[model samples]
Target chain A: MNIGTRSFQFHTPAVIIDQHTIAGPLEKQGNLTAEIDQFIPDLYDDEKTYELCYTKLIRQTVNILMSRHPLTTYLFTGDLINQSTPTHYGLMETLLVPVTFDHACATFGLSLQSAAFMLQQGQKQTVMVGTMSHFAAVEKQFRFPNEYGQQKPPSSQTTVTGGGFCILATEGEGPKITYATLGRVINAGFKDPYNMGEAMAPACFDTLLCHFQDCQVTPADYDYIITGDLGAVGQAILFDLLVHEGYQVNREQLIDAGCEIFKDHQPVMSGGSGAGCLSLFLLSHGIKHLFKQSLKVLVIATGALHSPVALLQTPIIPTIAHLVVIES
Target chain B: MNNKLFHTVAEKHNPPRPLLKNCVMSFIFGGVICAFGQCISLFYLYFFDFSEETVGDPTVATLILITMLLTGFGVYDKIAQIAGAGTMVPVTGFGNAVIASAIEHKSEGYVLGVGGNIFKLAGSVILFGVFASFVIALIKLILT
Candidate 1:
C-alpha cells in the first residue's frame, strides 16, 4: 500500500458518520467535557478488576457505536495492553470481524487509516476503528504497579483512562478521510521511558512533514493539526522543531491531544498519554467540527512503540506517527 | 529518509532531566524516611527497657506496622509518589510494596485475589533476601 512518498490518497473517501467516546473523570472536567459521550467518576466502571474496568469501557463504547451504525463490516481496534485481550474478549457479542493494531498511543490512527484504506479499496462497506487506555493498567504493565506510587518527573505523562470508538463508511455525510501517511520506525537514541513525549515528538514531526510533502499542502490548510500524546514536553519540542524547520504554523494550527486531556490545574505532570488520549479527544472535540463540514482537520497521531523490556535493553525508542486528513 | 528525518528532529530536541535535582530529592526523601525510622526506634528504646541488640526486632516490626497502616490509610502512596526511590530503600518501603500488591489484587477476591497475589512482588524480595544472607554467612565462615 505504498501509495506515493509514504502517503495514500483515498479514491473513495471514507466518512465518519458515527462515533462514541468514554473519558475518565479528569478528562470529563477538561475542555472537551460536553462533547464526550460518557465519563465515569473512576476507572472501575462497576467492575472488580482494573482489567475488567478497561474492558467494560471498550465494550460500552463499541456498543454505543454499533447501535448508532448497525450496518457495518468489521471492527479495527487497539489498546495500551498486552495482546489487546481486553478488547478482543469484550467484543464477544458483536459479529464484526475484529482486527487489532498496536502503535502505542497512535493505535487509533493506524486503525482509522486501515479502515479508510479498506473502504477505498472496497474491501469492506463499513468499519469501526477504536482505541482504549487505562492509566492503572498501563502503569502496572509499563512502569510500576499503580499503588507503588513511583515518583514521576515533569517529563513523564499521565496515561489517559478512556476509549474512543468510531465508524467509517463510504456512504455517509460527514468529515471524509481523504489522505493517509503511514510512519516509518525512526530510532534516535532516546532510551528513557519517563521522557516519552520527547521520544514521540520527532516521529510526529516526521509524519507531518511527509504528509505535507506528499499532499502538497501547508499547515495552514487544515483547521487543526492534532498530534497524539506528545504532552507539554513534546508539544514544546514540536514547536521548536517546526520553527527550526522553517514551518511558520501558528500555535492554533498545532494542537496536542495529550496536553488538552487534563485541565491546567490538574497535576498530570507533562500531560496525558496512552492509546485513548488522542482518539478520545479527537472523537469528542474534532468530530464536531468535522461533522459541521466547516473545517479540514489533519491528525498526526504519534506513538512510542517501545516496551519497558525492550527499552531497558536498548536506548533507542522506536516511534511512529500516522497521518490522516479529514476534509469537510 | 526516516533515519535522516529522525536525526533532524531528535537533534533539535533533547529530553530534559534534572539529574542533580532528582538525586537530591531522592536523597532527602530516603533520608527523611530513615530519620522517621530512627525516631521510632528512639521512642521505643527510651520508653521500653530493651537493650540495643534486642531493640532491633521490635523497632523494625513497629516501623513496618506503622507503614502498613499508612499504606492502608492511603497516605503512603502519596508520600512515595513524591519521595521517588527513597521510599523503597527502607524497611517501610518493602512494607509499602507488599501492601500495594495486596490492594492491586484485592478486587480478584480473597482466596484467589488477595491471598494468592499478596506475594507477587514481595515473594522474590524475601526469597532472595534470606538466601543471600545465608550465602554471605557461609562465605564469611569459610573466609574466617
Candidate 2:
C-alpha cells in the first residue's frame, strides 16, 4: 500500500536469494576486503579499456549468481557513464531484458525498489539488480581526466571502482524487502562540485524526514540506517540538520557506506563514492551483519542529479535520496 | 543563516588545507623533474655524442615520452595528487594530460575515440600557446 508521501509498504515478501560483490584492488585493501566475493587484481582486469573493465566486473558478478542460483526473471542496472550506453551494451548479451536507470549513486537503490515492486505484483518471480563504476572512465566524463592533474578539494569523494549484484525472489531463505521511500530533489543553495557533501546533505535530511513521518517509525526501528555516499563531511551536516529538525537518528546505527568501505588513513578525501559504493558495501559487508531473522536495515541511497551541462547554467545541485527497508 | 550553518559544519570537519605543504611538495617534485631532464641531456651529450645545441629537442622528447609512460602506468596521477602544481608546470605534465585523455577514451576505439578525443583537454593550450608565443616574438623583433 502507498504511504503518506512518496513511500511504499510491501505486504508480501521479496527476499534476496543470492548476491555477489566484485571490488577493484583498491577496495580489496579497504575494510570490507574479507566480505567481498572477488578481488580484481588490476583496474584493467585484462580489458583494453576502463568501460570494458566495468562491464567485466558486472558480468562476472552476474555469472557467479547464475552459476549458483535459479535465474532471475529480469536484470535492472546502471552506471555513471553518459546515456549509460557502455553498461547497457556490456550486459546486452546476457539475454535478460535490461532495465537501465541513472539516479547517479541512487541507481542501485531504485533498481532494488523496482524489482521488489515487480515481485509484489507477481509480474516477475525473481529479479537481478546490479551497478558499476570505473574511476578513470567516470573521471573523464564527470570531471577532468585523472591525468589532467587538477587539485580536487578535500571534500570531494573518490568514485570507487567496483560492481555488485543481488538476486531477489518472492520465495527465498534470506532478508525480505519491506518498504521503499522515494525522495525529492532538494537544493540548499550550495554550488561547489568539490564540496558535494554540503550540496547533497539537505536532500538527505528531507528524505529522512519524509521516511520517518510517512512510515511512522524512528531510528531505533532499524538495526542500521545507512546513507549511500554521505562520506564524512556530508554525514556531519546531515546529523546536525536532523537534530535541528527535531529528529534524533541513532548515532551508532546511522552510518554511511562511503565512510565504511575505506580505512581511516586511506587518501580517499571524504570517503568512498560512486554508483558501486553503496551496493558493494551493502551486498558484501552489510549482509554479513544480518543474522537470519535478526537484523533490519534502511538503506537511503542518495544521488546528486546534476549534469555538467546543467551546472554551467545554474549554481545549484539538486539531490535525491531513495530508502528501502530490509529485514533478515 | 542556513549558509552560515553549512559553512560552519563544512569548516569544522575540513582538516586545515596545508597550503605551505603543497608548495613545498610542488617545489621538490618540480626540482626532481628538472634534475631528471638535466641528466638526460648530459647522457645525450656524453654517451650519444650529440652536440649541446641539438640536445634540447631530444631531452624534451625523452621527458615527454617518459611522463606519457608514467601516465599509462597510473604513476603520474598519484604523483600529481601529492605533488600538485609542481607536476603541472613541467612539460611532463602536458604529456601526462594528453596520454591520460587518450587512455580514458581508448574504449571508444582509436579512430573517433582516442584519435579525435585525445586533445580535447589540451587542445586549447596548444592553440593559445603557439599563438601567444608568435605574437610575443613578433613584438620583441619589432622592439629590437
Candidate 3:
C-alpha cells in the first residue's frame, strides 16, 4: 500500500528465500571474499568474448538460484550492458518469465522493489531477482577499449565484474522487504563522467530523506544504512548532506557497498561501482550480518542514468536511488 | 539542497588530484621512452648503413612494433596508467591506440570490425597532423 509520496509499504512483506553471488578474481582481494558463493576465476569465464562472459555470469547465477528453488515463476534482472542483452540472452534456457530492469548500478534495488510488489499483489509465487556486471564488457560500452592506455581520475570507479541473485516469496524464513522508496531523477548539475559518485550522491540523499520521512523512522531506528556503489567520495558527501539537513548520521552505521567491496590496495580509484556492487555486498556480507543478530537495515541503491550518447547531448549526468528496508 | 549548494558540498568532498606527482612521473617516463628510441636509432647507425635522416623511419617502426606487442600482451595500459602523458605524448601511444581498438573490435569480425575501426582513435591524429603540416608548407611557399 502507498504510504507517503514515492514510498510503498508491503502489506505482506516479501521475504528472501535463498541467494547466490558470484564475482571475478579481482574481487577476491576484498574483505568479503569468504562471503561470496562463487568466483568466475577470470574475466573470460571460458567464453570467446567479454560480452559472452557477462552472459555466463547471469546464466550461472540464475541457474544456481533456480536449481535451489525450482518453483520460481519469474526472473527480475538487468545489467549495465547496452540493451541489457546479457540478462535476456543469459535466460534463453530458463523457463521463468523474464522482466528486465535498468537503472545503471541501482538495477538490483529496482529489481527487488518490483519483485516485492509482485509478491505482495500475489501476481507471482516466487520471483528470482538478479543483476550482473562485467568489467571488460562495461568498459567497452561506457569508457574505452580494455587495452587502451588511459589514466582514470581519482573520482573514477572500477566496474565490478560479478553477479548476485536471490529468490523472493511472500512467505519465507529470511530477510523481509518491508518498505521501499522510489527515487526521482535528480540532477545536481554535475557533469564529469569520471566522477559518477558525485553525480549520484544527491539522488541517494533524496531517496534516503524520503524514506526517513515516509517511514517515520530516524537513522537511529536502523542498525545500518547502506548505499549502493557510492564509493568513498560520495559517502563523505552524503554524510555532509545529511548533517547539513539537521540529521545526525552515525558514521559507523552508514557504509557504502563500493567502499566495502574493494581494499585500499586495489587500483580502483574511488572504489567498485556496478549493478553487482550493491547486490553482491548485500547478498554476501549484509545478509550474513543480519542473520547474526536482530537488526533492521536500510539499503539505498544509487545509479547514474546517462549513456555515452546522452552524455554527448548533455554533459550533465542525471542519477536515481531506490530505498529498500530489510529486517531479520 | 539546491544545485549550486550541492555543487559546493560535492567539490568540498572530492579530493584533489596529485598534479605535481603526475607531472614529474610524466617527465621521467617520457624521457626514458625517448632515450630508448635514441638507442634504437644509434644501433641502426652503427650496424646498418642508415643516415641520421633515414634512421628516423626504422626507429619509428621499431617503437611502434614494441608498443603493439605491449598492447597485445595487455601490459601497456598498466604502464600508461602510471606514466600518464609520458607514454601518451610519443608516437608509440598513437600506435597503441590504433592497435588497442583493433584488438577490442576483433570479437565483432575482421572485415567490418578490425579493418573498419582500426583508425577509430588515430584517425583524428593523422587528419590534423597532415592538415597542420600542409598549412605550414603553404606559409613557407608564400614567404619564399
Candidate 4:
C-alpha cells in the first residue's frame, strides 16, 4: 500500500532467505573479510579484461544464490559498468529473465524494492536480487584507467572490488523488507565529482526524511539506519543535515556501508563505494545481525547519477537515494 | 534546505585540498624529472655528433620511451599520484595519457578500441599545442 507520495508499505514483505558475497584481494583484508563468502585473490580472475572479470563476479553471485534457492523465478541485478553490460553478460547462461537497473551505487535498494514488489503482487515466487562492481572496470568507464596516476582528494571513494546477491522469497524465514521510500533526484549545487560524498549526502537525507514521515517512526526506533556507499565524508555531511533538520539521530545507530567495509588503516580515502559496496555489507554483515537479534534496520542506498559526459557539460552532480526498511 | 544553503553545509564537511603539500611535492618531483632529462640530454651530447639544438629530439624521445615502459609496468601513475601535475606537465605525461588510454581500451579490439582511443586524452593536447604554435608563429612573422 502507498504510504506517502514516494513511500510504499508492502502487504506481504519480501524475505531475504539467503545471501552470498564475493570480494577481491583488497576487500579480503577489510574489516568485513570474515563475513564474505568467496574471495578472489586477483582482480583479473584469469580473465582477459576487467569487464570480463566483473561479468564472472556477477555470474558467480547469481549461480551461488540460485544454487541455494533454485526456485528463483526472476532476476533483478545491475552494476556501475557501461549500460550494465557486466550484469547482462554475467547472467546470460542463467536462463532467468533479468531486469537490469542502473542507479549507480543505489542499485542495491532499487533491486531489493523491486523484488519485494514482485513478491507482494504474488506473481513471482522467488526473485534473485544482486549487484556487483569491479574497481578496474568501473574506473576505466567512469573515471580514469586502472594505471592512470591521478591524485584524488580525501573525499573521493575507492570503488569496492566485489559484489553480493541475495535470494528474496514471499515466504521465508529471514529479515522481511516492509517499507520502501524512493528518493527524488537532488542536486545541492555541488560540482566536485571528487567530493561525491557531499554530492550524494543531500539525496540520502531527502530519502530518510520522507521515510521517517511516511513510516511515522523516529530514527530511535530502528536498530540501525545504514546509508549505502556514503563513506566517511558523506556520513559526516549526513549527520550535519540530520541535525540541521531538527531530527534526533543516534550516532551509533546511523552507520554507513562504505565506512564498514574498509578498516581505518586502509588507504581508500573517504571509504569504499560502488553498487557492490552496500550489497556486500548487507549480505555479509547486516543480514547476519538481523537473524542474531530482533532488529529493525533501514538501508538507504545513495547513487550519483552523473556520467562523465554529463559531468563535463554540467557543473552539478545530481544524486538519488532509496530507502528499504527490513525487520525481523 | 535550498541548494545554496545545503552546499554551504556540505562544503564545510569536505576537507580542503592540501594545496601547500601538493605544490611542494609537485615542485620537487617535477624538478627531479627535468634534471633527469637534462642528464639524458648531456649523455647524448657527450657521445653523439648532434649539436645542442638537435640533442633535444633524442632526449625527448628517450624520456617518452621511459614513460611508456613505466606506464606499461603500472608504476608511473603511482608516482604521478604523489607528484600531481609534476608528471603531467612534462612530455612523459603526454606519452602516458596516450599509452594508458590505449592499454585500457585494448579490450574492445585493435582497430576500434586501441587505435580509436589512443588519442582519447592527448588529442586535445595535440590540437591546442598546434593551435598555439600557429598563433605564435603568425605573431612572430608579423613582428619580423
Candidate 5:
C-alpha cells in the first residue's frame, strides 16, 4: 500500500495501553522484566497515570497503523528513557522488539541511521518509529528551576502534556520518508554551571540551521516545522535568528513540547530541557493527522548533550537536532 | 514597707525611645503608603473606569513613578530608614529604586554609562533570584 497515495485514517480518542498488559507478555520472557517492575510500583497513582497516558498514545498509534497497513515490525528513534531511567527503557523495549539506544554523541541523524540499519538487517517489511515521554516524572526527579521561586512571566504558559507516535513502513505506495538528516553537534565546551541558557543557545542554533542546510531545503519549504524542547528564551532566540535569515516561520509551528506539556507558566527555569518533550509530542500529535492528509511535515528533535560530569563542572553543554521529512 | 517602696520604683520608669518611635512611625507611614496605593487605584477607576483587576496596571505605574520621584528628592531614603523592610518589601520600593537610579545617571551614555549601571543593584538581586532557583531545582533533580 502506498502511504503517499492512500488517505491515512486515525483512530479517534486515543487509549493508553497499561504496563500491566505489556508486562504480562514480557513476564513470559525472563527475570529482567521483574527487575524493571521493582523500580516502578503500581501503588503511586501518578505513576500509573503517566504510564496510562503514554500507553494510550502508543496503543492509538499501533491501532491506527495495523488497521491501515500490512506490516509486522516497528522502529523507535532515540531517548526511550526519559532520564536514563531503567523503568522507562524497560517499558519502551516491550513495545518495539528491535530497539537501539545511543549516547549524547549519536545525533538524531545517527540514531535514525541506526534504525534504518536495523530494518535492513532484519529485512522487516513495515517499521513503526515512535517515541513517548512523561516529562512529569523527569521534572519530579530533577526539580526544574521554575519550582524554586523564580517568577515566570505569563507568556510562558505554552508547555502542555505530550505524547506522540509515528509508524515508518517499508517503501510501499504509502507515505515516503523523503529525507532524514542530522546536523553536526557543536559545543563551545565552555564552563558555565549556573545558567545553561547562555551555553545551550549557541550550540542549538548552529546545529539546527546546519540540519536545514543538509536537507537542501529552506525553512519555508515545509508547511510547518516543529522543534523539540527549546524552551521560551531559546525559542525566542531561534525565531529571531530565523526571521533575520529571511525565513518567516510562525511561532506556533515552532512547538516546544516541554513548555507545552508543563501546563503552568512556572519558570521552566532554563525553559524545557529534556528528551521526553519531543518524543511525547511526536508520538501523540506528529504523525497521526499529517499522514492522513498527506501534508508534508518536518520534525526536528533537539537535545542538550550533557553528562553528569559536564553538569557538575558547570560547562556549557552542546546540543544537536535530528531532522526527518515525511511526504505523502 | 517593702511593697510600698517597690510600687514607687515601678511608677518612676519611662518607655524605650526606639520602641516608642517605631510604633508611632509605623502607624503614620503605614497609613500614608496604604492611602497612596488606594488613591492610585481610585484614580485609575475614575478616569479609565477600570475594574479592580484592571486597576493594577495603573496603580503599579503610579507607584513606580511616585517612588522614582521620591528617590530623586531623597525622601525615599528617609522612608526606607524609618520603615526598614516594610518599605522595601512592597512593589513600589523596587520601582522607585529602578527608575531613580536610571534617571540619576541619565547624563551618562544610554547603553554603557546609564543603562549599564542603572540595574547595578537590581541586576544582582534578579540574577541572585534566578541562580538561587536554578540551584534549588538542581538539588531536587538530583535527590529525586
Candidate 6:
C-alpha cells in the first residue's frame, strides 16, 4: 500500500493486567514479597493466591482486547518477563504465542526481524504488540541503584505498573508503519551500567541517521518526533548531540514519553522505562488524532540493551529503537 | 442620594456576576477533584488493603489516566475552563493538556500529528522550566 493512500487505525488498551501472575513469585521470593505485603497486605495471603489473581488479571486483559478486536493476532513485546527470568517468560508465553523475544544485545535486530516476518507472513490481519512489567519484580531482581544509598532518590516512588497494547492491522486502517529500519548496532563494548547515556550514544546516532536515510526524510520534514524511554539525562544528551550534528528538532515537538510519564509532581526522577511507555502514548494520543488529522508522526521505541549480568561486567548498554510512521 | 451612599448601595445589591460565578464553580469543582483523589486513595487503602505509600502510586496513575481519557473525549477543556489554573497546575492537569493537545492535532500522523502536538500546553512550561533551571544552575556555578 502506498503511504499516502493508506488509512491507519489503532487502539491501545492500557491498564493493569494480570496482577495475580506475579503474586506467586512474590510469595515464593519471600523477603521483598513480605515488604510488598506490608503495603498490600491482602496480597500476602498465599503463594498460589497471587498466581491465581494474576492469571485472572491476564485472562481479563486478553478477554477485553479480544472483545474489542477479536480477529487480531497478539504479539508479546519485550519485558513481558521483568527480569529475563524463565518463569516470567513462561508466564507470558502461556498468555500468547511468542513471535520472538530478545533482551539486551539482540533486541533491536530481533524486534525488526519479527516485525518484518509478520508483515511478510500475512497470516494475521491484525497484530497486537504489547508489553507489561511489575516494578516489584524489577526491584526484587535488580536492586535499582537508587535504592542502595541511605537516602532513596525521590523518583523511586512513582514506579509504574500495567501493560500497553497496540493493534496493528494489515489492512492499513491505522497509522502505517512506513519504515521499520534497523541501524547497525555499534557495540561500544563498554561496561558501565550507571551511565547508560554515554554508552548508547554511538547506537543512537547510527540508528537515527539510518532511519533518516531509509525514509529519505530529513529531520526538518518531521513536525515532531518522540523517543522512547531515554530518561532525563539521556534526553538531554540526545538533544545536544542532534543539535551538534546540525539536525535541530523543534524542542516543542520533540518529546520523550519517559519525561511525560514522569511529570515533575511525581517522584520518578528520570522517567519510565519499558515498552509500555511508547505503546501507551501511541494508542492514547499518537494514533487517535494524528491519524485523523493527517499529520505525519514518527514513533520511535528505543530500548537500552543491558542485562544485570552485562551491567556487572561492563557499563555499556546496548540500545535499540522500533520506528513506526503514522499518517492521517 | 449622596454619591457615597448610592455607590455603597449598588455594590451591596450587585456583585460582579462572572467573578462570583467563577469563585463558586472553582470551589465546587476543585473540591470535587480533590474528593476524587481522596476517594481513590481511600479505596486503595480499604479494599485493596494497600498502605498509604503503596496507594499513592496507583492513585496518581489513575488520576493521570482519567485526566488523559477526559482530554481524549474533549471533556477536560470544559473542566479546565471552569477551573482555570486550579485544574491545569496539577500533574493531572498536565496529563490533560498533553493528551488534549495531541488529540487536537492527531490527524497529522504519529510523527507529525500527535508527536508534534504532545507539547501544546506543556511546551512553554517545559521550555521555561529548563531555561530557568539552567540559568539558575549557571548562576550558582559562577557564584560558587
For residue B78, what is the lDDT in candidate 4? 83
Task: Name the candidate, 2 or 3, with the larger lDDT value.
Answer: 3
lDDT of 1 at A68: 78
Mind giving the per-residue lDDT tens digits that candidate 2 earns over A185-228?
77777777777777778777777788899989877777878888
- Which tens-of-lDDT digit does each residue in A29-117 have in candidate 1? 77788888888888777887789889899888888878877877589888878899889878988877788987888888889998987
Q: Please identify model 4 stretches exceeding 4 Å from their true place.
A: A289-291
List where candidate 1 sits over 4 angstroms from the true fold. A1-3, A289-293, B1-35, B46-49, B105-144
Q: Which residue pairs come into collision in candidate 4?
A: A149-B77
Q: What does DockQ give for each predicted structure?
A: 0.44, 0.45, 0.84, 0.71, 0.01, 0.01
**Which rank order by TM-score, best down to worst?**
3, 4, 2, 1, 6, 5
Model 6 misplaced stretches (Cα beyond 4 Å)? A1-59, A80-95, A104-113, A144-159, A188-192, B1-144
The model with the greater TM-score, 2 or 4, is: 4
Assess every candidate by TM-score.
0.88, 0.90, 0.98, 0.97, 0.48, 0.53
As for DockQ, the candidate ahead, 4 or 6, is 4
Pick by TM-score: 4 or 6, better one: 4
Q: Rank the models by lDDT, top first.
A: 3, 4, 2, 1, 6, 5
Estimate, for each residue in B1-144, the C-alpha lDDT of model 5 and write its tens digit.
122322222223211136556656656765677788999899888888799888988888778777777777657755665664456656765665566556544545688756776774467678998999999999999999
Candidate 6 docking band: incorrect
lDDT, model 1, position A234: 83
Which has the higher lDDT value, candidate number 4 or candidate number 6? 4
Best by TM-score: 3
> What is the lDDT for A275 in model 2?
93
